[model samples]
Target chain A: MKVKVPKTLLTEHVALLERVIPTRSSNPLFTYLGLALTPDALVLFGTNGEVDLEVRLELPTEGEGRFLVPAQPFFQLVKSLPGDQVELGFGAELSLSSGSFSTRLSLAPDEGYPELFFPSLEGPAEPYPLQTLLPVEELLKALSHVRYAASNEEYRAIFRGVQLEFSEGGLRSVASDGYRLALYRLAKPQPFAKKVVVPARSVDEMVRVLKGMGEGEVALALGPGVLGLATSGSQGAAATGKGQLRMAVRLMEGEFPDYERVIPKEFPLKAAFDVEAFREALRRVSVLSDRQNHRVDLLFEERRVLLSAEGDYGKGQEEVPVRLEGLPLAVAYNARYLLEALSPLSGQAVLLLSGPTSPSLVRPGEAAEGYQAVVVPLRV
Target chain B: MKVKVPKTLLTEHVALLERVIPTRSSNPLFTYLGLALTPDALVLFGTNGEVDLEVRLELPTEGEGRFLVPAQPFFQLVKSLPGDQVELGFGAELSLSSGSFSTRLSLAPDEGYPELFFPSLEGPAEPYPLQTLLPVEELLKALSHVRYAASNEEYRAIFRGVQLEFSEGGLRSVASDGYRLALYRLAKPQPFAKKVVVPARSVDEMVRVLKGMGEGEVALALGPGVLGLATSGSQGAAATGKGQLRMAVRLMEGEFPDYERVIPKEFPLKAAFDVEAFREALRRVSVLSDRQNHRVDLLFEERRVLLSAEGDYGKGQEEVPVRLEGLPLAVAYNARYLLEALSPLSGQAVLLLSGPTSPSLVRPGEAAEGYQAVVVPLRV
Candidate 1:
């Protein structure tokens, strides 16, 4: 079998597959990427047992063939080739030729390659509404805001995924690690009403693909055990295009914990301060905090907030003015957790507190409709 | 004791001292930075067992006092302070106060600090001319060109230092690790004729300080066992300035190996190629080379060079045009060594090969006056 494709398009397709391929595996066949050539198009598949990605490029071919090639070296070689027409020939071995460069690659046994099945979007036996169109930018923004809060602990498999809840009004993305929680709400409602928990690793791969896409719409489909996302040139012509990229990830098997109870509803003290100024103060004072606990004390007064940290080596303190209402309070928090939560906010931030042992809430000062972060305070 | 100094100047002095202080040491006193305050100026000192550094800042004080503070926390705290005047107070403990912040730091025992001695430039029994003035930019440029070639092997102590040879014609800096060598020559001659071996760590610290200096002159002083470098304002006002910064590094005790015999005097094959193009080809081909040997074969023919690498996983090949002369030859080299040697060259590069087994030399295409790099080829 033989095929001819533009060098630039081939390079782009290989780069997308490289992100999903596993670098090392006990089974030798798992380390190779599978390529199937048909009469109309060439399909590339890569999987790490949990998440699988398939990309299709429109190319005119002569015959049907299937082969597996080592992921690392082949990806690197194609990236270095010049932007011209590239010819590929396959038999017992694979040969790639471009310009004055030609090399032969030994192929892995095709018998050990796993069979891949993509979930169908439209079928008579389908139970759920599997097709929904979403704006690409809004989906990326919602993931970035809540991905960091997902837990990495393997014991509790439920917290290792981010929950996507769809309602009549909007879509809510929530993540929690028992110590902190982040909630992001997007106000673009769709006709489908369902809930799904996507694994953290799959969310990361989705973000990488979405960032490179042009201004368009992404089509999402959910089946029994898998979730698929596909993107093309534009919204109207998504089904028929020159080429398309699709990713299917296995959904988590457990139920996520209830996070609404974690957020404190009643607050006796509220303080509004500049986000930049508060972040800078925490950065300076935390330099002297204990390395293990990273505890920093915050003392709220009538119109000011004092931050201090004391360690075996020395002590540090800083003062920043704030607009305070209700009763004044004092609390201790891990400096690292606070820094991560405040880094994404802009302009001003409002902090709500109930008591020394209660969880604290952080939100944007002017708008509290879309996003919120809750952090558990440490004992002073 | 109490004194006032500008925050910017104090931070600069501490930054210089922090480079020489060891974070962990068996002797507890080695982890502290000593500050000795006199009527006219303040002196700061830090040392490991192998190297020592001292800096002076002119400030008015009432009496004399000596104290030692933890190096890490103190340096970090001072860097975070606002750019304003800071006050220092010393009693049983050290106190630092700035704006609305203040902290107390317990001091290490003064008796545990080591005694320091500085070599004099105007001594009566001096044998050689001790002082030579040079531009800061020239000194920094010379150090950056040849520092990467220094060896870090502990068994061969002589190979770990950079040899500084000063003569009537010029100053030469040379470093070698048995496999590769780098030579950098500065054409400004002085009246002093001396040979010294400075440790690699000291050379790195000197580069850091010289990069931070303004447009000024640095005065170098040599004595029995130490090398001193001092810099102030412009050359005209160097002698009568408010304060001056000085650094003294202990000279290495071992004799350096002779490096002149390693440079080849004759070559049978000469190839001139564009540096940028050659570097890009090597980078791409090396991705498929063996991880342990990193061997890449270069085949030199009529007017071109073919570079190729074969590994267990795959194979890569690239062809680059070059101007060749003399006998045709083929040689194999470690890709990492060739990349490092060619990265610093600006224009075209000339490769001079003596034979398949002998070392090859790389120099600028236009001139061979100031710099050269020598690399040994691997057996394929």
Candidate 2:
């Protein structure tokens, strides 16, 4: 197989493939990337067993063939190649040449390369039971806000993922790590109700792929065991035209916790504080918080809220002015959780509390965005 | 003790101390920084057993006292504090107040804090046998060129240091890991000859200190077992004023190898190539070089050089145009070593070759810079 392609476009696509390719795997074949040339395009494939990614480049070719090469070294060679175009030829070995630079990469045996499922919009044998199209911006915004709260603990399968819930209202994303929960409502209603828990690791890769797709609506197909995302349009006006990217993730099989019941419906007390000032105070006070629990106390008052923390190292206190309503109250929270929950919000933030030990709700200045978070107070 | 200092000045000084203070140490006392308040200045002390650093900031104070605090936590608090002016007070605990933020840090047992010697210029009790002041730029340039060649192996006492040679000719810094050698001559003659080997780790800290010192001359004092570096004045006009920093590093004990003997004095062949082009070509070809030796072969012809490398992955080749002198030659060298040695040079780089298996010379386009490197060839 022989093909000549623009170096910049090739480098960009290879980098995307590199992100999904595992550096090492128990199945050694998984560490290799499949390079296949068809009559119309060159395709690159990468996977970590659970998630697979394919990037297609449309280029005029001499012959058609498929081969596998070590992902990392091939990436390095592609990035380091000089000039505007690179010619790839497969004969005795996979030969790559661009300007004065050329390399013969030893091909990994292709017999063991696993067949990957390619998701397409039009296909009679499509395995997906449900398919939906949503604005990339809205989906990305929701993922960014909720992804941070997902649990990283391996034993807690359901909590280690971001739950995508579809109902008559809209598509909502929820993530919780027991102590804290974050939920984002995208407001894109679906025809049928559905729920899927995507592993946090794969969610991160999906974010990367969606970002690279660039300013276009994404088509998401949901199956019993697999979730597929595909983008067919070019990146931009001057981008490599007609190239396509597709990604698939084996879904996590488990029931996500009933998070709706835990989200507080009523708050007897409400306090609005400048987000930047409150965040700064929390960071300073948390420096002295106990290492084990990272607990910081917040005492709500008439015109200000006092924050304090005491640990083996020392004790710290700071006061931030807040517009308050209802009776003054006090709460103790894991400072790290509160900090992370506050990180994705800006302008003014409202703290809605029910009692001392109950989960408190945090909302952005404008609740119309449908972004909310809940933090369970630590027992003193 | 009580004092009010500008937050920016305190932060800058604390950052310098943070560099020398070990995050964790077998001697627990070494993990704390000594905060001493004098009538004239506030002095901060940090040490890592082998190296010590002190930063002095002159500020008006209400009282004078010296205490010790956990270095890392205190640094974090100082960095996170708000406002421009910070008020520090010591009573039951160390109290720090900046704007609306305040913290009381529990002091580490000050009785156990080690006593560190502060080097000065006016004292007759000076223990240094030799003292010299050189332009910071010259010293920094020399250090950058030679530091990379120093061996990191802990057992190699002498090779794990950059040897400083002060003689009638000039102050020359040299380092070698046995396979390669790098030397930079400062051309500033000394009054009395002296030689010292500063450990590579200490050299790194010295670099940081020198860079922070900005535009000025650095004073170097050589004791029997310690090397002292001190810089006075401020960083710049719009910087912390009247602050001073001093650093002491315990010198490595051992006799350095005679590196001059390996530097080739005569060459039967010479090849001059564009530094940027040659470097790019080398980077591309080295992607397929053997993992262990990283060997890349150079075949010098009449007007160009061919570079090739083969390993388990595959083989790569590239051609770079060069002005050749004397007989055509072929030689191989570790790509990593050659790359590092060439990193400090630009414009046209001349390769002086003596033979296939002997140490070759690498010099910048204009050799007047007094920088030279010797890389031993790998046997093919």
Candidate 3:
């Protein structure tokens, strides 16, 4: 196989490679990226099995055959080369040549390369436009916060993945690390869907790749042990290149817990205030919280909300005026989760969907667009 | 204590506090930052006993007074408030008021705060201008690479400190963590000086603060358990604030190891090339260097060099042309240290300061300005 591709496009594959691929994989086979240099396109993939990145580029392909170089050299060659076209050749000897420099790299046997999966969107596949998949920015924001709540340890295999439930009203994503749980629900939803626990790493990589593509319709296909994402029409104007690309990754199999009961939907006492204002306030409050401390309790009244943290020395309380609903109530929460929920949101007002001595959901006004939830009341 | 100061200055103090104060100190006493809010100044100190930060802000004294508050709250409070002049009034209770926000923070007994030994940079203190101090940027670059080689764990208390030696010729800084050693020397000397082990933390913090400021005389004072750095003139014309202010901190005590013997003067082979060109090549080569693998084994021949790394499957190598100095020789090294030494200078050529084995010094051509050294050779 031989192909000449634009250096910039090839570099994009390198950029995504580092983000999706784990620096150290216990299995040596997993460390190698799958590089398929076709006649019309050069497709690059990097994954540790769980989180994979597949970036496709229509290299003017110049009709080359196919070859797969080891991840490191392939990435390094593309990254170091000058702008213009990078000529890649495969066969008896794999070679990446550009400008005055042409280096031949050793290739691994393609027989052991892990096969990526993409659920066929043909039969029984729900059809949804790119826009309908979910706004890239909003999804990125929700995933960032919820992903943090996933257990990074090997204590509970299932807890490591974030659970996502999609129904008619919207999509709810939940993650728990035993100690604390974070929930985020997008108010807008597709016609109908179910739930699944996606490996946290894969979702993060998918979000990072999609975020760079601007506003575009990303077709998503969900299935057992596998998932697929394909992009077509963009949000604003036509983005450069074909934009029709697919990334297929394997999913972790486990029993995701029922997180619905974890979030208290009926917040007895509600409060409304500027989202940024509250976010900044919570950030300040967090600084004073004990490094070992986890939640900040919210004491809500008719027209004021008091955020407080009790530590060894004393209690730290800050009150901000806010119009509330129902009787006065106080609910505790992890200040970090609260701050995370507020960070991505942008709105004039934030509505605290709370409950007495129960978990509270923090959602910004419609203008904020994004959604985030923090389960509180860990107890004093 | 009662006084009003600019928020910007207070914010700067907080920035310094965030780094100097460790989140948890072995001794609880070290956890509290000694705040001597005298009528004349606000002196704040945070130390892990190993590395300490004592910063004094001269607040115009109007009414005579004093107080001490918890460091974290004080930093958070001042940061949360708005406006320039922050009214800080205290007697039995400490109240810091700004704009419409008012926070009354409780203070710890001033007696509980430890008294820091503020060194006398006063008596007959000698001043070393830029001409003698070596380019601050050179010192910084050298420190950046060498500090990483220092042991993070203080198994050898003195080894954790960066040993900086001086003589009539110039200054050389050395740091090693048993596995690797990095030595950097300047081309020329500035007037007079002695040697001392400046704690890596102190050197790092000083470099960070120094980067913000310019070319001026940095008065040096080396005392028992102290190394004072006071840059008197404007860091540069583009510098900010009253650049005349001097910042000094104490250093660690002890005679550093004799490291000059570590750099061998003679080698069987040597090759010279452009510093940047070699650095980039080494960087690409480093993508495969792991603790388990000696990334590259370099061979120097007639005006040419070959760098090869043998992986689990096969071997890969790159040949670069250079200026040869001795007989052809081959040796292996951890590619990282070699890449680091190849950085930090401006010139078209680099002189390979070599030894018998892979242990060699990569001196970027500006030897008259600055120089760097690295010791390598383990498994090839």
lDDT by candidate, in order shown? 0.78, 0.86, 0.62
lDDT of 2 by residue, A1-380 (tens): 79888888888888888988988999889889899998878889988998999988877778888899888789888888888888999876898999988889999778877788856866313677677777887788778889999998877779998888888899999999887899999877876688898989889999888888778777788877888887765633125544688889988887686778899888999999999999999999998999999999999999999999999999999999999988999899999999888888999999999889988999998888878999999886
Report how far residue B20 has shifted in candidate 3, in Å: 2.4
In model 2, the clashing pairs are none
TM-score of chain A of each: 0.88, 0.94, 0.81
True contacts kept of each: 0.75, 0.94, 0.15
Local accuracy of candidate 1 as per-residue lDDT tens digits, A143-244: 777888889998868889888887778888888888899888888886678788999889999888777665677777777777777776322111343356
Q: Tens digits of per-residue lDDT for model 3 on B66-183? A: 4556666666666776456677776665666665445556666756555544333343333312123445566676577577777677687877778877778777778876656777
TM-scores, chain B, all models: 0.86, 0.94, 0.79
Could you arrange the candidates by DockQ from highest to lowest? Answer: 2, 1, 3
Ranking by lDDT: 2, 1, 3
Better of 1 and 3 by TM-score: 1
Please give, for residues B229-248, the per-residue lDDT of candidate 1 as tens digits: 77763221113332456677
lDDT at A250, model 2:
87
